[model samples]
Target: MGLLDELESEAQRRKSNDEDASVLKAARETAYRTVLEPAMADLLAYLKELAAKLTELQPKIAIRHSLAGYGDVVAYVEHEFDVREVRQPSSKEITVAFHAAVSSSECPSVQIEGGARVRAVSASFQRHRLGAPLAASKDASGEVVAATFKAKGRIPLTAVFSADAASGQLRLSFSNFDDFATAVKTVAPDQVNEELYDKIGRYLMREPTDLMREVLPENYRSQLRARVHHEEVKRRWESQIVSRQQEDIALLKREYGIGARFNRIGDAMGKLRGLVSRK
Candidate 1:
């Protein structure tokens, strides 16, 4: 009778232990499905949207296009003109290169000689505005013609009329005029909007290291030890999931007469499900 009583006591203890393990396993499964999976899904969706926005705002120059990408952004523009000798008092000519990125264009050449005194040179650019008027003039011998305009107002201004005529070719030059005009009328509004959007996206997605330092409290360490600590915590949480799964399998095998091999397989499935649902 004494030996039988001891055996019964051991059985009861095993049953109680199995009950506790089962309760913990159920709670963990519930938490994984209810909380962790949704959080991870939301995080990935937001990152994808951010990458798309960053690709839209780059500038266009010549045949090449510029814009930001998921991890970075870029913008560029180019302008070209030529200078040639003509039969007139104006022995020298000037050209201006304009880029929409800068929003301004002006002839860099200074103190130009052998022509009528070029009092001033300047340019302006506007993304979408009505075309402004320009004027042209001819030399006394009618062998040479030149165009010029004054600088006025804020950005989005037109280039002054200026050109060099030679060899039956009239090379016209204007600061911001041609590009701005093309962008406003020839380019589709949606295309321009997309470029601007990309620029804004790039600005927003810039690395946040500087911002993080500025915003962190005094208690925060400069070495980013917090990230390491967070990773350790995550590791521990995953380990707990594995431990819980093993305990569950042990309980099932001991109390429910489930085979050891079958319990082991169930434990693996539980572990996979836990990881999939974890935040």
Candidate 2:
């Protein structure tokens, strides 16, 4: 047979075992494309984005923190309140802690001990507040210059596929309780069929993913631009003040040098004039 005829015969041979062949291909394809590389890309993007966002953010922020309403949004670090008793150090000096419960209803704040490690959330967004628009926070000393108001934002999306075509029935066809528990934890587990994967993908994509995004504020662009402009202006002003101070110092040095040489030059010119007159 010719090369094309041999290839046709091979294709026919594969078609006879199509069911098993398809399962093997699907496993390999999902492993290579959907799980490994895609997962890596997603994780890298998340890490990089978080790193950039938290670079300028503070670890512990003073905010009027509440989960009810959004305030001026910015980087925030949450703190875990723990009750622990102070204990004497051992030879290894490992600090040990046990659950310290109290009869009081309120969770009392404990004074932090020096050199003792406490539970804390670091390098996370607390909330962004405006210098002008936000309310000023103050203390016994004086007025505090910190961002007060905080708000949050969400990403928007649009559906690319039609509703009728995308709609599907997700029913519990299997009777395995262990499989159901695993599915609840990770959406899938070993011995689970491929249709479950497809159903999860479709559900996630359409419900919370890009297919159905969020609604943003109308003046979001203006607000973002204004915030950036304020930051740039503050930076520029400080830079100009530093540069202007340096320039003034240099100008003073130049003027003082000229003043120091003026009298000596004048005296030399007088002596030279006197010598010329005598000649």
Best by lDDT: 1
Please give, for residues 1-279, the per-residue lDDT of candidate 2 as tens digits. Answer: 999999999998888789787776566545434343333333234434433443445234322222222212222222222112222221001111111111112222222221211111111113211112134444467634332322332211111110010111111211111111112222111212444334433432222322112345769978988999999999999999999999999999999999879988999999999999999
Which stretches in model 1 have alpha-carbon errors above 4 Å?
A: 54-279
TM-score result, candidate 1: 0.21
Cα lDDT for residue 110, model 1? 24
Residue 128 of model 2 has an lDDT of: 17
Candidate 1: how many backbone clashes? 12
* Each model's Cα RMSD: 35.8, 23.0
What is candidate 1's lDDT per residue for 1-279, written digit by digit as tens? Answer: 699999999999999999998886665444434432332233234434553433354333321121111011112333221222222432122222233333223311122222343211211212222122135454687622343332222223222211111111112223333223221111111222333334323322332222112245556764568788898999999999999999999988787665766889999999999999994
**Local distance difference test scores for all models:** 0.37, 0.35
